[model samples]
Target: MPPHVLAATRALNWLELVTETMRTALEALAAAAPEWLIAHVDEEWFERYARRADDYRLPDGDTARTAFAVTVGRDGIALLQAL
Candidate 1:
């Protein structure tokens, strides 16, 4: 498989794990903040770059392709140890 595909697959797998583990909590969050569940991306930019576009740019120059968005509350943090 291509590198991008592999990366996406890994991300999706991790997403599945997260959603499964926190189904109840996620459901409540979805009810309270539905917008948080929406995926973040620039449609126009995505049209040009497709999956090749980096969704986020780090201060250190690294880039990230986020499969989706998850907005935990202001003081909330979600961390995945391994995926």
Candidate 2:
């Protein structure tokens, strides 16, 4: 597997765990950051990135490819997983 694939998988797994354990996406962000809110990403932006990723396929070229965007509201903090 590509290095980025492994990283993406890890991020996805973490997100799943957060969502599962926290119940609400908002809750997950709060649990992880205690002061933030996060929600589903904008569909248009996500799809645009997905298209680019399919053509370029640069491992870890962009954040979206590594993990689905979680719209961390003003309350949330940026959580970047170790790459």
Candidate 3:
């Protein structure tokens, strides 16, 4: 396959992985921290998160991907700390 085709395939695979991981994380979060999710996470927030996860794309480059991961990690930590 051409380079562009290969790249696109890889991106699609990454997106699928991210989507599944997000779904699993959401399920675990709901089960493990139902009270926290209920108090802090509104319905709108859940809808927005679901949409984003369903349509998520991998960041364009290594630096962007790293930044995205770091931001997510920080956000998760902040949420946990708020509990």
Candidate 4:
């Protein structure tokens, strides 16, 4: 598959892995930090929350797992808002 397709696939997978409530929270996060999704065209660094071992708690007291994670060199970002 192509790079854009791969990124889209990985992003969908991340969204699918979470619950409805978590998905809403993650969407908000994604909207706030668009740069977190940017990566090199040839890079393959997306991973699930469990394997990444990153979790976070929202202000509403709900927990969110690591929906997706990626890094381009030293600028790494993780979406820890999908349970």
* The candidate that achieves the highest lDDT relative to the unseen native structure: 3
Model 1, 57-78: lDDT tens digits are 2112113223233421111243
Which rank order by TM-score, best down to worst? 3, 1, 2, 4
Most TM-score-accurate candidate: 3
- Taking all chains together, each candidate's TM-score versus the true structure is 0.33, 0.31, 0.50, 0.24
Worst 10 residues of 3 by lDDT: 47-56
Which structure is stronger by lDDT: 1 or 4?
A: 1
Q: What lDDT score belongs to each candidate, Candidate 1 first?
A: 0.37, 0.40, 0.60, 0.35
Candidate 4 stretches greater than 4 Å from native: 20-83
Per-residue error at 52 for model 2, in Å?
A: 29
Model 2, 1-83: lDDT tens digits are: 99999986776555444433323443344467643332433334223232222323433434753343353221123223210
TM-score of 4: 0.24
Ranking by lDDT: 3, 2, 1, 4
Candidate 3 local Cα displacement, residue 74, angstroms = 9.6
The lDDT, on a scale of 0 to 1, for candidate 2 is 0.40
State each candidate's clash count.
0, 3, 0, 1
Clashing pairs in 4: 65-82
Model 1, C-alpha of 55: deviation from truth (Å): 20
TM-score of 2: 0.31
Off by over 4 Å in 1: 24-68, 72-83
lDDT tens per residue, model 4, 13-67: 5544443333444445456764654332112332221132223321121122232
